[model samples]
Target: MLAVAMLLTLGLGGPWSGAEKAEAAPAFAKGADISWVPGMEAQGYTWKDKNGNTRDIIDILKNDYQINSVRIRVFVNPSNDYGNGYMNKDRAATLAQRAKNAGMSIMLTLHYSDSWADPGKQTKPAAWQSYTFQQLMDAVWNHTRDVMYAMQAKGVTPDWVQIGNETNNGMLWEDGKASVNMKNYAWLVNTGNNAVKSVSSGTKTIVHLANGYDNALFVWNIGGLIANGATFDIIGMSLYPTASDWSTKVNQTITNANDMISRYGKQVMITEIGLDYNQATAAKSFVTDIKTKIRNIAGGNGLGVFYWEPQASPGYNGGYNKGAWQSNGRPTIALDGFIN
Candidate 1:
């Protein structure tokens, strides 16, 4: 009993009279990709709770909706375009700090470009257009490290960092296209991975791809990366299913996630998911089912699920209709899936 008391007094075990308590292990992460919040707020947008009480969006997400994580995307040198740009490193770091202050974990996605990098497009940043292969690799490392340093300056260490966004065929165009030169893609992934580790070793690195339900694509993409000696900690995916097909897509995605875990021994994260704002009922069911299924993955290899820009209303960004927020400036029932 004396030893126990002494340990407690030393703040090593048990509750103390005044010392800070140890943080509990993080629960299954329910998250939101609200990278548009800053820009939206700047445009005079405000969020309201279900009861119509005006509140900070992050507060509503964390307190009312049970969202414990926030995913922010960082672009290298974004233009002033509202939807296509404005998420450069400094702004991202500021948003990350705000999310951290609200007691939410952070996931930093490095797009390595001025705009979107996805399955359909992976254009290199214009400044990096003239660089050779070696210079491109160096640019990747430097940009990643610089972003990490920016986050560090804000005293926010991201819990997870994605090297690229929805890189189905690979990123950085012809130089790093998987079909044409997978070795170059692998090298880029390694460079980003190494840069992230150099800043914060505890930050897990993710290589993301779109279409989480496509097992063959994952097999080809991830298998190629592994074959060419790519190193990463997690396999991230994007799943955007319509109201009618969500059930089927969710099941298929779960199967693909399991295969990824067993084949490569890496964890899986659903980095992006959404349904149309008008399909609130179906979206609720879809989110509930997918979250439950992902949590049930064997060995706890499933990391978390993040709704893509759930705060946007219809027509906010070039007719993006998939946001979970309603036109009345409140979240729809779709976000209720995270409440449990």
Candidate 2:
């Protein structure tokens, strides 16, 4: 309790005003995730050149685009040259501060791994490399409380939080993996829920599951948690156009998830969804179509759709994936379309 209290004191706290409820939005929320760094190299652009430059996702909302919010990922401790950013409570607090400074609501993603927490790489942070199960639970609670408090102190509390990224199989996977490997998956997930609940009194905590366009199997895996009384405030899922038309896929996706939400009386958020513009000429339209389909299915049902790293264009300087992305890779048009 002392730890959580001290952390919240550093920065974080708040319930958005009633008027701030996307109340003016005639439809559903259209949001994107973009963060500017002094130096960042993804696949193509360099960071030094784009240094001090800003890639404001909120610009879409403030400008002609109708975007209502932005999402940002925070790592426990990225083991890369991204130089210890958004990796800890302090960094997350910094990013959240900027988001609120832009007058935007935020969706916070907690990557349990030191770098990324996608299904393929959910390694626990170095500090917890050998932690016992109970120790890891302590780590999760301490970290969650610290970050939430930090954000509140800065007056940048996230509107929603993903307890762990695309955790389809479970997180910190040495023993949490679900598929034929970790028998403790459910317990691990519930432990994480308790961690989130400790600091989520005014925020909505989401359990995220990421899979290809057709993710019924994985979603069912987590749905079992809900059925078993695991607590969560949102049904969060990640969608990518891997096997079928994203639009058609998202349609079924929303319906399937909403069926669960309708049953549980919970809200939903398409926490991560996108089609790389570099993949095809139809990339732009592909993304726009998914956003529209999501909104159509969730219009009044109160669904939130957030594009994942849709703005990961080349930095003016070198970045992590420098050999791949282009400077103008972000689909500004696609973003404008979704929000509008």
Candidate 3:
């Protein structure tokens, strides 16, 4: 008893003693990608609480669902491809402003195109389609700088910024296609990262990829990035399980996340994740399990998980079945998993 008291007084204890350390552990962040909110609201979609009270979805998520971070996607010129642009630079700035006002951390995902830029189609913005590789690199740097600058001017610096969205096949196709030409891809990626740092030095950068459950794909994409000298702060992943196979996906994602930290010495985050809309109970379980797995990662490198477009109810444009809201504009039980 005397020895134990002395050890406690000196802030030293047996190997099993970590009471103070455990108490100091930071809270795990619960996040959601509400990139479609602006567009959906503009289209006359309204969200309500479980009590049928109209509410700003952002407020509800943060206040009720315990979401602390919000993710928004920014397109170079979405209006160029679709009428009435949404997710463009100006709109993104506005959304970021709102998020900041709501006291939530912001994550800006730059698609780097007029529309969607993903594995199947990483088409360059129509305006930059004719630029040479070198010019394309310049375009990337300039656009990133402009967006970051615009957001900063609004007194809102993103806590995290994704250089590209689901860049499995690479971004700015033909010029920066990872599978086709890793050198160019790395150059563009590094340029974007540099641009973000120059504009907002405090903002962390992320290299996003789809299908967090695929270890081989991560090895192919992220490994290549590291090989080609493409640096980033975090490895962001998208995990969307089909049917009820979330268990497998969650295990694979945790494995990939652990490998990413051990192999590359970087942090990991689930930038986008969703389950079938009808599977609210399963979604809750998946979120809970995934969050636990991430927090359990050996180091404190497992950042957090962000549900992809949880407020997008079915029947709304781009309202995927995996959304976490019900048809009545109220959150489903799936969102409850974020409550810590």
How accurate locally, in lDDT, is each candidate?
0.86, 0.59, 0.81
Poorly placed runs, candidate 3 (over 4 Å): 1-27, 80-85
- Candidate 1 ranges beyond 4 A from true positions: 1-27, 81-85
lDDT of 2 by residue, 196-220 (tens): 5455555667778775344466456
Between candidates 1 and 3, the lDDT winner: 1
Query: Candidate 2: misplaced stretches above 4 Å?
Result: 1-27, 35-57, 83-86, 180-183, 242-244, 262-265, 279-281, 314-332
- Residue 26 shift from truth in candidate 3, angstroms: 8.1
Please state every model's RMSD to the true fold in angstroms.
Answer: 9.1, 6.4, 11.3
**lDDT-sorted candidate list, best first:** 1, 3, 2
Q: Write the per-residue lDDT of candidate 1 for residues 1-340, one digit (tens) a residue.
A: 2343233323354332222111232557799998999999888889988999999999999999899999999999888665443799999999999999999988999999898889899999999999998788888878987898898888888888999999999999989999999998988898787777666766888999999999999999999999998888999989999989999999999999999999999999999999999999999998999999998898888988999999898777779999988898877899999778
Query: In candidate 2, how many Å is residue 27 off?
Result: 7.8
lDDT of 3 by residue, 1-340 (tens): 2233223224454332331110111245589888888777776788987788999899999998889888888898776432223578878888888988888888889999888888798889989999988788778878987898778777787878899999998999988988889978887888777667655656778999998988899998889988988867899999888656898889989999989888899999888888887888999898888888887888678888999888888755643688887887877788888876
Poorest lDDT segment (10 consecutive residues) of candidate 3: 17-26
Candidate with maximal TM-score: 1
State the weakest 10-residue window (summed lDDT) of model 2. Answer: 16-25
TM-score-based ranking? 1, 3, 2
Candidate 1 matches the true fold with a TM-score of 0.92
TM-score of each: 0.92, 0.76, 0.89
